[model samples]
Target: MIGILYFSSTGNSLYIAKKLKENLGGKIFYLPKYSGNGSEFEKIILVTPIYSFGMPKHVYDFLPKLDKSKELIVVQNYGGMVAGADYLMREYCTKNNLNLKSIYVVQMPENFTLSFSVPKFYLKKVLKKADSKILAVVDAIKNEKYNLPKKRKTKEKTYLKNMSNWYKIGKEFKTNENCVKCGKCIGLCPVGNISIVDEKIVFGDKCVACLGCYHRCPNKAIVYKNKKKKNRYINPNINENEIGQDI
Candidate 1:
């Protein structure tokens, strides 16, 4: 059996995880503030985003809590035209004592709306193309019948330096008055780092910096620090049916 474990702030990773499930034949589990068991699978896929050159805090917390006996595959999505996330997975796999079977990295648009400012129409086009690539990888991984590029020698000091700086310059999510306080952010957070108190959203240190709260808000009530000038992405692939369901 296989288990699909993933954290998706804005559906790009989720879409990929769903497609992977179609190929791998597994039980699907989401990582948010609330989660469930994955004990039934012999194989598992860790799907998430490469936030600020590192793994999201939610994923790190959720992963350590998972049953590590299963063979692991990692898929990380990032903004297009950037680097891949294999090195991040290698470090995580090493720290967690899991044998990583394979690593797949993809570049999607940046999820933070106020950061990169990708146009909605253009983003939809990109998602359509990216979806095809994800499906191709699913086929390759399921067959266990392909060769991957040789692992490149990495600069550990550089990698750590980048990840450290990102964590240090952590993201802050602020909910605007427009927030209906519907508790969507609270439920969507894989690590239970957010809560709705007195009709407002509150955050805890457990935040993984996934930006799900910021982008997933229905009314665009959540904002990243100084993000007024940035562009946000709303998944064109999703609508009311799939919305508000943890990315």
Candidate 2:
């Protein structure tokens, strides 16, 4: 059986995985909830969002535990650009003796509202592009297309340097008085880094910096260093419960 495993914060990766499941016969499994040794499937497709040109911390932690013997296809959904993330995943698989089959990158709407605003027109355009890209990827995977890592360019190198400070990102997230202590952030944090203390939301050091809580907040009350300038983005095709983190 084909197994599609994914780690998604705001549902881009999850949406892609669901589409793949519809085109190809497979069962979708959330990476954060997966605990098996990965022996349940004959083939595996791993999907995740690129965070600051790198893989999420939870994806990094979960990679070593995956079954290296199975045929593997890796897909990364990116908002802006995917720098060395593909190379990094390839290196990890090589070192772990995993049978990496193929890798593809899909461009999705940028949901990182801390830095800039994603206008509705631009978001719609990117989402349309993402759907087309996902179809191509599905076709390639169906045909068993194998690929090697591309030559790392100078731009990718620069992105890697810039994203190197990703660990310091979540520390700047702050909530305003508009917060009603709804506890959504506490539940939607993928790494369980958010909680309630003294009836207020608290962030812990274990944050993976996925931005799930900030984007998914009903009140749009969570801010990072400053207030948000754009509207919150959740995949228009996906429901809140479909992507909600059950922490």
Candidate 3:
């Protein structure tokens, strides 16, 4: 049996997990909501999106709990450099003695609206290319290719510095008059970092910086440092409701 475990904020990693399941035939589990250690599954595929060029803190915490004997495959979805995380995961498996089989990094559409411009017009072209890469990746997984991680030259030190700043990012979140108290962001946060305090949304300090709340805000009310970017992005291949289902 195969189990696909994934952590995604804006649907990119979830989309990749679904594509793998379509060909590989496995049950899917959202990592945040999942309880067990996955002992029943013989093969396990872990999918996650890169944050600060590495794994999300929630995903990193969940890694040690997985069944060590199971053959492990890692699929990382990224919108930018993956070097820090590629080395991090490989090193983690080596140190922990997990049955690490393969690792793949797939480029995804950017969802971090507060920091970068995610142009809607370019999504189609980007998705097309990503789909092609996903197909190739699925084929490789099925063939037992066992493609491993390679050291790619990147600013890993910069990534670490950025990660340190991510902890304080939620402190910058504030809503504008456009907020309707709809509570959508309350459900979208994987870390439960957003809440309604006296009928108004308030951000907590546990933000993992996935940007799901920022991008999926219906009214464009949620912003970092009182600035909402003109464009927000959710994966074109998946809907916001589906992404929120994990919550």
TM-score of each: 0.78, 0.90, 0.92
Among all candidates shown, the one with the greatest TM-score: 3
Ranking of models by lDDT: 3, 2, 1
Candidate 3, residues 151-243: lDDT per residue as tens digits?
655455766688778858888888889999999889878889999988889999888887778878899888788664567777778765776
When sorted by TM-score, best at the front, the candidate numbers are: 3, 2, 1
RMSD of 3: 2.1
Question: Where does the lowest 10-residue lDDT sum fall in candidate 3?
Answer: 238-247
Span of ten consecutive residues with least summed lDDT in model 1: 238-247
Q: What residue runs in model 2 are displaced by over 4 Å at the alpha carbon?
A: 153-167, 244-247
Which of 2 and 3 is ahead in lDDT?
Answer: 3
Q: Which runs in model 1 stand beyond 4 Å of their true positions? A: 33-39, 62-69, 81-84, 146-149, 153-172, 196-200, 226-230, 239-247
- The true-versus-predicted C-alpha distance at residue 70 of model 2, in Å, is 0.5
Highest lDDT model number: 3
Of the two candidates 1 and 2, the one with more favorable TM-score, higher being better, is 2
Native-referenced Cα lDDT, model 3:
0.80
Please give the CA lDDT of all the candidate structures. 0.66, 0.80, 0.80
